[model samples]
Target: MDLTRDQVEAAVRALRPDMFDFAYWVPEMAKEYRVTSVLYSVVSATAIAHDLSPGSELGVPPPGYPSSKVLFRAHDAHALSSLSIFYKRLYHRMTTGLMNCDIISMRTCQEVEGKFCDYIARQYQRKVLLTGPMLPDPEKSRPLEDQWSSWLAGFRQSSVVFCALGSQITLERDQFQELCLGMELTGLPFLLAVKPPKGAKTIQEALPEGFEERVKGRRVVWGEWVQQPLILAHPSVGCFVSHCGFGSMWESLMSDCQIVMLPFLGDQILNTKLMTEELEVSVEVPREETGWFSKESLSAAIISVMDKDSELGSLVKRNHAKLKEILVSPGLLTSYTDKFVEALQNLLNDTNLE
Candidate 1:
């Protein structure tokens, strides 16, 4: 599979193989579990070698079996290894680079093949299954409702925007400061749910000096984490400025707030692709090489999204209502799970019969 340049560097430093030949040995292990060894790739693209023989790509197999070259679009590395004994099912769904339409039989997106691949993956590990956001059911979620409303009561009327940057990725100081300044420019109350930067004593280090004081009267609050779902659901939160992480996208969409996106790294770019091009519900900030976003640009994006007259806002709200009808339905999620289990059971039975 394609490994990002960053991922490759990490592998080189951590694995520290004595020779390049060490790479191909992974596929040999997969053969023992009925996996057909194919090409060895780098960065999920770039095929390093095809059906590389012993001593061809790798010097020799290790004590264990060769690793399978599994790809799951939505799954993190851990989820793939956990779900199937032989196959790896990715938990999320998105395009993985471009695919060949001319090819007779090949799938493009991984979500389509996730369960099937997961079945094969189970033949190897079969311990961990990739899962989606296990959000609390809206109907059953009670205390959460009260807690959310209580938090909302503190915000100034029509002044707050909820900001969260998913679970991964942090902003550098310049970016954070610019973002804060943008909030200040809006002259509205704001809630920034920020995770601290590495080795930093406080979030204020990344913020402009006097920012906290400048925005003091208008209910500017910052914390390492907030009950994100509840925050989005709050009536006072008129908009969302986010990193466009898929989970955050889904959360914001369901809550019916207009969204301004600032995506960082990996699938985030692709997620923005769908949001801006496909869904038409959100706006994205332009990112620079220095990883900095301008306060002016941020301010503009925020103003546009927050504007009630903007067509995008109404479109987002309408799309959100429709999406909620599907996403919040217990039947949809349960059906997917039920299908996954049935497939697994059928595969297991065949293996036993064999």
Candidate 2:
């Protein structure tokens, strides 16, 4: 297929921009390449507007939404301000990119984040196009690894807990041991895939005393990557303890597993709230004022969701199942992609006419 420079630029820019220093170049790039559209994660878009817009009234809850439903509370603002210089620069670039783009898009759908999406569109005065979750097609992907398959098969259906904190989150040594011990306290079979904690050579070395012996044969604390989606799809995997990263959020939504969110970053915290509060599809482990979660809290959150008789468990399961059915329904993802393409084509045609 033949494509214009604008089309190629749009496609490349659709992937999230990582060059923090180049955010200032967005306007120049768009003008030079005639770039028709740009996409931003919904959280970053909202945050950019919140931080940059003059007299932005985001702190107040929208009508019909409770005070608890406000997207960014006072504490959230403090947290945002306290981020390291690197993140602060990254956010600044994201803000510039959002401000310069002719078209704004997100890798999410209205069903899950309609209110927030609408708020962003109103704030930016631009149409916010959603590309749905854009998850990978499991059918086309490779099968689960042989080791994981055989081990997961050993457990009863929907009985194993799988915890993966994504690649970026690295806990302190003590916090890492707490997390591992928390899984052990659940007294349920689990697979924990995470980076070795700070100051540890490997996950094995970071474990609590007697941890491996105490939970032998029932737990796997892997320090390397695992096939997360395929593991979540495994029959024996019932609960997913995730960090609520955007990709993991979609994967968790599409799977049948119960979700237990333990978000560590800024956007992750917002995603956790969206899952636990707005959608009511997942439970978040309670954190102290210092933003640390105890092993007991983690275990309790998992137990609450895993217990067959727990009311909270039943409620989230029912809600999650309903949402999953909609998300996985035939052509739902394709429909979003088709509409997004049509919008892009229309924008290009309008530009040509002008």
Candidate 3:
């Protein structure tokens, strides 16, 4: 009723570039047109990129799915090469990913250690450009952004801290104040994105009295949310204080910012451990066996991540740079497609004759 089909198509094309996670969606569009050669897609109400011959749309979904697609990496293009070597023992628990049912059969990962997919069918991880947490509405993001630039202007590159726990992570009142005090003690320039606790209207209400005045002119305090990628990518932001949500972690790494992990819950705890132990890209705030945390420990964590002279800090800095290099490499996305095509060819058992 509003526009002709052509007009609608043009609008979609024009808007695609600015869409959320547009980078991932580009490949999705390609698959829609059958441009992708490797991943078998059976298009229905739900789009399923199956573990089948490249370009193979086998009419109907099998009962369990992927009797032919190899489950895990038989090789490393960061692509899933083959199916489970352990299918016999876990067959009942596992089933083929049904696209209509909202399952990603597999994906590529940046590193071997990165999570690819879930356990049920076949899944893995690969780096893709994240879409959210970019610059906020220019009109709304003003004055504060200007202030960040001004505050960071005198600092050296990779020097300041940008703190933004995602919207989901809310701190207890005492914990919030403790961290605020810690940042104040660091004396290093920082931007804290504060979210109000449940039952609170604004973050300021949770502040310990005079805490704002104490840190006034010394640190930057922001509202419930900010354009995190913008802050992380800022030249002056060397360290990121976060709750270690996977998206935030990736954004930080992509922006070349070192992590100061303050994990609050389940996967976050595991993620912080992995980022520290396996990737060596972040340092966790110290805690005791009883899982107690202190303002002193919080302060020390900020110092450790930002002070490159310290040993762990130095190691984290190097890893941060390395991760950034991998994330922004021009060839990374191309390689994901290339690997899928290669795997698809293998599945069809079709090779070019020499």
TM-scores, all candidates, are 0.61, 0.86, 0.60
lDDT of 3 by residue, 144-258 (tens): 4665667777777877788877877766777777777777778887788878755667778877789888777657777656767777767888889887766676566677777
- The residue-level lDDT of candidate 2 at 257 comes to 98
Give me the runs in candidate 2 sitting further than 4 Å from their true place: 1-24, 40-87
lDDT string, candidate 2, 59-93, tens digits: 43333332254265444443353344435455456
lDDT of each: 0.51, 0.77, 0.54
Prediction RMSDs, each to the true structure: 12.9, 5.4, 12.0
- Please name the candidate that would achieve the greatest lDDT relative to the true structure: 2
Candidate 3's error at 260, in angstroms? Answer: 1.1
* Candidates sorted on TM-score, descending: 2, 1, 3
Best by TM-score: 2
Stretches off by above 4 angstroms in model 3 are 1-144, 289-292, 337-354
